[model samples]
Target: MRTFCVTGFGKKLKKHNDLLKIESKEDDNDEAKNLLVSPLDFDAVIVSGEHDITTGAIRLLLKNEIDLMILDHFGNPAGYILPCGKSKLIERHETQSRISSSKALCIAKAMCIASMINKISLLRSIQKNTGVDIETHIERIRKMTVQAESCLEINSLQGFECFSTNEYYSALMKIIPAEFNFTGRNRNPPMDPFNSLLGYGYGILYSKIRSAIVKAGLSPYYGVFHASYKNQEALVYDLIEEFRQPIVDRVVLTLIARKQVSSDDFNVTNEGCFFKNNFKKKYAGIILTRLEQEYTYENEKKTFSEIIEAQADILASAILETGKYSPFIYR
Candidate 1:
């Protein structure tokens, strides 16, 4: 979908001008504030700047049908939101396909519980007739898959005992490249630390959303490589992971590399760490521009949203009739 990112580091904005573009219908000076529309407007806004959200801002965001994100100091979203009608907004979103509801639920429940390894197993199970090369991105998937299992183990048996979320996140921090920056600060951005945290969040969210799509009777896992996750929709993660590299992590890098933001843009509060007032708009701009650009993969050029939608279709067909889910494993 269209993801509009609006961040508020130190201040929140009340009005959004994204939807209203000025048009000139009459003579040169007879310009009225008419509206111009883009077929691909932003779908949601990711706000990571403050602890307590402003009600007026929430209302504005909801009216625009935008998704708002609130993250802690380290940039992790706190588990609370202001029910700004986003449920309804996201709910009626035209799903990518038409699959049966019961099949979707079963696939979603299964995917939520299965680890990356378990998923690989499921992929392997479905690989025979699909011709997907499980080995294509095996190295990266292997590392993250192992860690996901470890996280579950740590959460379950240890009762979150051995490591705090911060500690876990801290370890994740180790993966981003040392040059990775958030808004203004040069935070460590290694692959595992960076990708894993993002992957974890995306994995959870995909299951939540895919289940809805599946219930709408769409495919969950007809991916190119991981063709087997058909009923469960786990294959979407296979595609989304490709995006995390260019989307989130790259934006962080662009800001740091360009010296546009620094550590001063963040703040630590009781709720957790969040963006300071200074850098929200700047960070949001990065994501916006990035989304507008064409991304090249597998010798074809496409927008970020288009690529993901293709993956959704792949999943839809897989669930509906044992179709193959195409994985986006770039060289």
Candidate 2:
């Protein structure tokens, strides 16, 4: 299964037998026609708001249990379409009941500690390749991880996370080239090209994790570490912490180090730096490839996408008190 991203205006999607066909109504049709034959060809379809999808296509997608993600003009997630008739009511009820329980705290702390470990591990990997001395930074984050594990309250856990990440990013910026001008982390229109790539990659990752959580019969709104916010997928936010460094951060850093992304790839507006359309597609492709890459986990090789779903399943088991939750740690 794969993911198909649809963009542009006047695009129509239809189901032809077992195949999915896309046709463009624009006059200048350079990249208009597309066909998705087998149901196994794609598991997800990401459609931009500019495109028009037929009802038949939607029905077919739902029948095939293919996840659908809709993005707004600015490349932010607007909505999602998940399959119906699949329910794990007991798992969900347990999740709601355990919100304030000690189990919740354990899961939250585990996620934070896993995140810290992955960040430190990524830094070490970079240092090994580039010969950059990041031992001080790694040791500091290691101490922070220990604090996170001992934290009984969510507030203190978040505090340790913030401090650890601040130090980690500070060292990370020094390792990268100065031309990217990534002083610090900033979102809601990232301040620099590096931050822009980071934000974009994280958004893509959020959508993937959101789908996985829903498929695992958990609520995306209810969370352990991150509190629910209006219009926010809080649980997705919580689960995504452990993955941010190993997935998106690593991809963006590789792109920058290899000089694959240039200043011309971004457009500087009054808001901040944004990736141009072509560059955005290129970046998204890289992220998707990274997510599909196979890695060894628990003595078995699994794609990063599978790891995400497995993590959600583990969380559900933990919520149900049937098993313990362990966050995915990159090796």
Candidate 3:
């Protein structure tokens, strides 16, 4: 699926006949050029920064069944305009509520195992490339996987999951530069540059997964592993587990390794460490590019973005008892 991204400020989208007339300005004093695009050409349009969309253009997008994604200044999805009239909404919610405990446990275990496998894969890859030995952490996670498989309850499974996550971050700390001062995974105000980039990237991924869940007509508040709490998108949290190590972690590490980002690009405030405003746009671009990268999936190449949507649909089918659910494991 094609996704067109509109960035910068003072951008405008207007519907003209069978096309969308896009006007973009880099600065307020500059006269920008207008470009025409067909709504049929892309599956989604992402708007970042300050932009204007005419009512006619909104109608055109809606008529074409195109998703309209609005991104915040930091590139996290603020909101989305998805095609409406989803069928079986009541049935889907009812099925979700009635999912068997055994099935939920099974699904949750699969998700944790997938996450562990991805973590091991990443650690091994990093070790191989950087000549860093994290075999102890890797072995610990391998053992944790066996323990996780035997878990009879979600809480126990989560314990094993948490152990593996700590091991993964500890392994990363060994390889990440000392200047970054990464001391393991901490969030809700990440304390180090490494974690700052990680939190931001994960925020972007979270929004994408949440949008996929919404498009699949499943309630994000209901989940197999993550307990539903007030205002929590538990299912999104649950599903994001499988992709975190492979996507956001990989992206952040790659940026640091390649020197695409450095300590200077971030600032530590009383709130927490964070990327400077200038670096956020560049980091967001890299994350989006990674999402668009193609990888083998079920014998065919599919972008991570496509895979996310497919996984959401698969999960919905499983919850509705129309199909079986499988967690995504990155190679």
Candidate 4:
């Protein structure tokens, strides 16, 4: 199963029998001719920018039980199309019942710990190559993790989590090259190119994790760590914490450090920085490829996509009291 991402203006998607055809109205003739016409092999289709999609394609996607994620102009996930009436009620009941329990707190703390560890690992990897002294920052993050684990309430845990995350970003800024000019993590309208890429990558990751949660027969809105809000995928947010640094942050930092991307790839205005349409497509492709790379986990090699699904299932099992939940800590 693969993910198909459609970007650019005047893109049209249609379903013809078992085949899905994507036609780009752009002037590039070769690009339109190279579009993939095999929809049966796709697990999901992510559509970005202005495009027209046929009802037949939607029907085919639903028939195949494939997810369709739609992203806004700024790369924020706007909505999703998923097959209805497929979730099991018992699983949702278990999920709700466990939300306010000690099990929930434990899972939240574990996520925070894993996030801190991954951030430290990333810093250490950077230090090794750049020969920068990050030991002080690493120890600070470790202390914050210990403090996070001791919290009995969700509010306190969130506070410590934010503190640790801020500290991690501050330390990260020191090690990265001065060209990226990454002062701190900003999201509202990501002020710089680095934050812009991070936000866009995170949105893509959120869509992937949300799909995994739904496939595991769990509700994405009802979460233990993050409170349910209108149209919010809180469970996805909770589960995505441990992966944010390892996946999105690492990818963005690598791109900046290697000078793979430039300021010309983005449009900077008084509002904030935004990736150009073509550059956004290229960036999305990189993240998708990263998600598919194989890695060793729990004595077994698995792709990040498979690991995400496994983690979702583990969370479901924890809710059902069939097993305990453990966050995926990057080694």
Candidate 5:
């Protein structure tokens, strides 16, 4: 996938209009480095903006294919999910039979299974020639599978319902403290900044992303393990969720802990709350850089994007019923 970084002014993309478009600002880039997407094309598009962007600056995004999203100053989302209108633009697939939600879930379950199997395979790869304890790894898989199952729960009524704050942050509470500050004390009630409006903002973006992804017909289940819905794209959720525990959540906490990002990064107005451009750029940098960096998985190190795409592809294969179902549960 092509990664386009939009910096400076008057930056115009030199690539052919037909190729994939990925990684950009909410508006045009005057001097984007030339790239070739080839046959596969750009997988996704991320738009980062400092403040209010030109009213129609986002029009270019609506013309592409694949995922598109706009990030705000506070490291939150502002709900311009149409990164590429052509991607969300659907033509009736008269060639192949369309699957219902139940059918899709069945396939998605298999896809999740494939992802889990791949994880095990990758773990073995991580161990290298030294070898790993199969029994121990099996146990870990079992435990992680249980957690994945919970995330995959099919809550039709509530599955599609989104929260205003980052729900993943709430999920993390189960494993870690809702720290008032990254390394500071937690008050008795614990109802201050940690659980304040900032949290609420994260939740809003999370839900919007989920809603938009589902509406686009991309499986959210395949991406992350969140509450599942019948007609939603659960696959991407299956894929992205793996990063949530250690990636997005950790970054947010660290920002708070180091005081890199504070309440000042965000401002609430009657028009609705928004983050500062610098804040969005910071969070986006953190997320992208973290994802690009290598981390140990199953005792072996790999880039975050590698594992993420693997999970997503596994779901794609499963939906196609190319193999059995599986789930991805990280250790």
Candidate 6:
């Protein structure tokens, strides 16, 4: 299913016969600014910034079991409008709540290890492309993975994971073009263009994983790796580790390597680096396309979207004691 994103201010969505009609309130006479889409066109709608939707349109979406996601100014998910009868497995949530500490640690370690493995694989690809001798960094990350196998506490495992991530970023910085000014990973208000793209990409990834978790009948706030805090979807954070390197980082690095993006694509303000409207739209389209890209898994071709949904199911089965959980390791 596709995801329709609504951006900009003074926009309105309404039901027009069997189709959903979208138009700009600021210029109602402008046909070029209007769009008509079927409810079947997309399974989810992400509304960014200010917009208005008629009750009929909302009813149409709900009738089709479509999700409506609201994004804050930073492109982070503010909330969601799920259908009234969406699954809410109370038993599954109880099982999650009663998970033993040792099992939780096991899951956390597995996720971290899988994440490091994927990072190492990406680093190897980078090494091949840049011809940089980053064997030291690779070895260090490999060592961290080994240590993680025996890591006892969640905090300590995180420490090992963090160190490995630093080395991975360090290796990446060595090969990145000097013009990008990428030194390391930074977020919230990403200082550099690279980080600006990375942060936004992660935000989109978070939304995808969160949606997967919801569809899998799991609680996003209850997680194995990350502790729940106010308004935090800790499980989404946990699952995202295994994907950051393989999904978002790979795409961002390729964009840089091919010189497909430049400083003009971003807006550098005192607040931080942010994407220009044209580039943000294009980059988001690219990220969505990546989700749709297919790869071989279990001798069958599957999209990353399908794999993510499967991972969510795996997590649920683990919590329910029906099956084992293994994070997807990107090669």
Please report the candidate that would top TM-score against the real structure.
Answer: 4
Local accuracy of candidate 5 as per-residue lDDT tens digits, 1-331: 3333232223333334544332344464323344344324444455444323332334443444434455443324445444433344333222112544554555444434444444444344334522433445544554554444444443421232222112322333332333433222122222344433334333333433443444434544343233343454444344443344344545555565466766666554544345444454445456556556776655677765555555444544454445544444554
Candidate 5 residues lying further than 4 Å off, grouped into runs, are: 1-45, 50-153, 156-234, 270-272, 297-300
Write the residue-wise lDDT of candidate 4 on 129-165 in tens digits: 8887877888898898888878988888888778878
lDDT of 3 by residue, 16-131 (tens): 89899987665543243688999888867877678899989988988898878786644455777776753224446877878898888988898999999999999999999999
Q: After superposition, how far is residue 236 of candidate 5 from its true place, in Å?
A: 3.3
Q: Provide the clashing-pair count of each candidate structure.
A: 40, 0, 0, 0, 52, 0
lDDT tens digits by residue: candidate 6, 1-331 = 4678776566899999988888876544434477898988778787766789999999899899888888764567788888876645445688788888888998898899999999999999998988999999999999999999998899998899789989999998888888778989887788889888888777777788888888888888888888644468889999989889877999999998899998888877888887776577678778878888897866788888788888988998887685778889986
Order of all candidates by TM-score, from best down to worst?
Answer: 4, 6, 2, 3, 5, 1
Worst 10 residues of 1 by lDDT: 157-166
Question: CA shift at 219, candidate 5, in angstroms?
Answer: 6.9
TM-score (C-alpha) between model 5 and the true structure: 0.49
Order of candidates by lDDT, top first?
6, 3, 4, 2, 5, 1
lDDT scores of the candidates, listed in order: 0.41, 0.80, 0.82, 0.82, 0.42, 0.83
Taking every candidate in turn, the Cα RMSD to the unseen true structure, in Å, is 12.1, 2.5, 3.1, 2.0, 10.0, 2.3
Cα misplacement distance, residue 267 of candidate 4 (Å): 0.6
Listed in order, each prediction's TM-score against the native is 0.45, 0.90, 0.85, 0.93, 0.49, 0.93
lDDT, residue 125, model 1? 34
**Model 2: pairs clashing at backbone N, Cα or C within 3 Å:** none
Candidate 4 — which residues are off by over 4 angstroms? 26-30, 85-91, 94-100, 228-231
C-alpha RMSD of candidate 3 = 3.1
